[model samples]
Target: MSLLAQLNAPFMYLLCGGIILFVALVCVFFMIRAYRAGKAMGIDTTKMKRVITASATFTLLPSIGILLGVIALSGSLGTPWPWLRLSVIGALHYETQVAEAAAEAVGLQSLSASLMTPTAFSTICLLMSVCIMWGMVFSVFFNKRYLRRLGAGSKSGKPGGGFGDRAMTAMFIGLICAYMGSYIGGFVSGNGLFRCAGSWIPLGVVAVACLSMAGFMWLYEKKNAVWVESFSIAGSMILAMAAAVGLSALA
Candidate 1:
């Protein structure tokens, strides 16, 4: 059978659907447990219900981006896998990067459905599933210790009090720089996915995204637009994607 056919097969859908259902059950179980625990702690049931309602309402906005991610990935990787991944532990950026890397490792230029094969698809699925688990595995063993250390540092009021926050910020900055460096390199060397004059598209899209995010943050901080916080990331992503499409057309 064809790669897309295999990807979207009945069994694939069944497997993904089963996994998502299991996750939903686990979430519901935790929700009930938490609700009971809150009552035992003397928290009012009405307040707890309000908190739950607010949490679910806030989740809807971020979920739109996840839904968009699934749509973006579904064109090449198929619907079931993307749906399962994003519904579970996967982020849009991480999934796209890993999938593209896996496809390239298997001699595919991109994650395009037309360029994909069964082997390439398997490679992507394996890599995406396995490679992203290291953080969770480490957390399973060390998260408590890490939290204790972080708490101690905070209590001490020393220069190291902010170490955890600083470390996380540095890591995030490093990741952004890595991606930006690749885009700049591609722009300069003309060695990116688009070797033509369009090699700068990635950089351009990133710039647009950054600007959009900055505008949203300004609105939130300066204008006191409280609702902008939830939409900032999703709004920037949508704008960046639109910019990419426009640039691609121009190219």
Candidate 2:
């Protein structure tokens, strides 16, 4: 059997599902433990429930999007790698780029199930894992200190507050610019990168998402609807996905 076929074998799914189940159990254990701790400390259980509801509602959309990403990558890389990466420290935005970079480094233009060999698959997996490990290592060692410093600065409410806000804004802007620039460059270069009709779908999706979010924001301001703010992200995601489908069909 081919490497891709092996990767998609039943054993891989069982292994992936086992790891994911263990992680989920660990997460639930900690959550329940924390809830018990709060109860012992006489924290209001009612307020805690409310907080949990709001947090879960906010997180649901993004988690769905991440699952969609895992599905997308699974078609090419199989289920185990994407499932493991995304279930842990992996960000949705970084997975494709990491795969693409790893593939390029191995003298492949891109990775696909049909074209991949065992050696190439293993190399890409190792490279992507190692590349992300630096961030995980730093977080393990320095995350507490980083949060402490941030808290101290916020309390000061001077250069700390302003600088923190600006820094975060700049960071997000930089990330968006980098993603957008890469797509724009690919389209402009047209070196077979944009040759496929489906290549334009991502651009359409982005535009649709942005426009939907902006429209929701405007409506929120005018109508003073509290739910609009909550649903904005979800609405944009759904509309963007629909737009992608429509655009792909048209193309």
Q: Choose the strongest candidate by lDDT.
A: 1
Segments of candidate 2 deviating more than 4 angstroms: 1-6, 26-77, 91-124, 150-162, 180-207, 248-251
- TM-score, cand. 1: 0.61
How close is every model to the real structure, measured as TM-score?
A: 0.61, 0.64
Residues 1-251 of candidate 1 have per-residue lDDT tens digits of 87888889999999999999999999999999999989997889987876776566657656887899899999999999999989888887898888888888889988899998777788888889998888889989998898786685355655564567788889999999998988887787665454443387898899999999999999999999977776677678788889999998987
What tens-digit string does per-residue lDDT give for candidate 2 at 71-164? Answer: 9989889988898879876889899889988888988877788777788888998888888888869989998889887774355545554566
Q: Model 2: which ten-residue window has the lowest total lDDT?
A: 152-161
TM-score of 2: 0.64
After superposition, candidate 1 runs with Cα above 4 Å error: 148-251
